[model samples]
Target: MKNTKAMRHSGPSAELEAKGLHRLAGERVLLDNISLSVHGGDRIAIVGPTGSGKSLLLRSLAMLDPIDAGEVQWRGESVHGRDIPRFRSQVIYLQQRPALVEGTVEENLRQPYFLRAHRDKHFDRERVSRLLSSLGRGDSFLSQHQRDLSGGESQLTALLRAVQLDPAILLLDEPTAALDSDSTAMVERLVIDWLSEMPSDRATVWVTHDDEQSRRISNAMLQIHDGKLSKDVHERIR
Candidate 1:
């Protein structure tokens, strides 16, 4: 299936973008010809009811899911094949429930560096400790075993792992859903601080059900309903 509208390529290219994206489960549409552009410094919040295809959209943008129709581009070029690993490294996706290795928090954090995509990068203890400090965690937090961590702590560890990799774009799927207010604030601060460190080179797209969080984290908000974006937000984003 093809989108009726032409794919957009004109104007300044976005750091990440979807052009005429579509996904289907049999005959039912899971995503409806979605097109969006995310530039550096963008903090986008996607808000919607359950089953609105919000997670599907984020996964598609990360290229973690196959699309029935459309293309994803990074820096104006179509991403494919050998380029996917690099693309995934730069655009990291964090699901609602983070998966951690069966080891200490520090071990989990160090795991990504073992990947070929991040072979040139080493785990930075000092930087991670500083970030832990910002979250009110002592250096010993790293020594705690993953099995002993609470939901909030696991989420923090997961966030720390991703941030330490220094990804250019973060696709957050309700990262703070399981946290209390204080922990949520810490997550927000950590993300804001990371983006501030590279304002013109980093961006995030957060899928959240909390209206307050959407207002707090995003400069732009898009609403999805029944697998389609609201008309107003769709026009603005396109």
Candidate 2:
């Protein structure tokens, strides 16, 4: 399967779009000709039961999993192996379980600054402090050890840090799956608020099993079943 026109736009648009996404692991098919057109500011939720290929589809879009068939187009150009890393920086991926390094939250948050793209840029401590606070964490979390933090705390910090990277698109896989209700709500609020505040051109593809979560944050919904996309659902409410 191939998508001739990978992106569709009504007006101005962002370059992020998934085209002809198909993958297979051995004999098991993970995705079948999945194509999604994402304009700027589109909040998409991918929802399905376990083993429905929601996460696999996200991995394929992120280019972390090799596609047995199909390709991803960014800015109307097909992205190959060489462009993946750079594309990833613009299109970030956040796993359900965020792996924190062995250090303070501050150090972990600052890790991305060491990358060449952010090397010369000054670290904004104030921004980090505010983000942490918004996620129900305090400034003291900066001094806390990553290993000592609870699952909610760690995930909150990870999400704040990822958003600060200012990616054009964020691919989140069950972002709040491990959190308590309060923490989950906080994270969800953060995502919604951020998307609402940011330029209307940013896009987010969130993979989650939580129906309420999906309903709250998604403008469009995609359901996956048996390794295939089962039509796009327009109305948010069932």
Best by TM-score: 1
Task: Give the distance in Å from residue 96's predicted Cα in candidate 2 to where it truly belongs.
Answer: 0.9
Candidate 2 lDDT at 70 equals 79
| lDDT by residue (tens digit), candidate 2, 135-191 | 666788899999898898888778877887877788999989888998898878777
Clashes of each: 0, 0
Best by lDDT: 1
Residues 109-219, candidate 1: write the lDDT tens digits: 999999999999999999999888877789999999999998888888899999999999999999998889988888899898889898878889999999888888887
Return model 1's CA RMSD, one decimal.
3.5
Work out the TM-score per prediction: 0.92, 0.90
Q: Where does candidate 1 have its weakest 10-residue lDDT segment?
A: 1-10
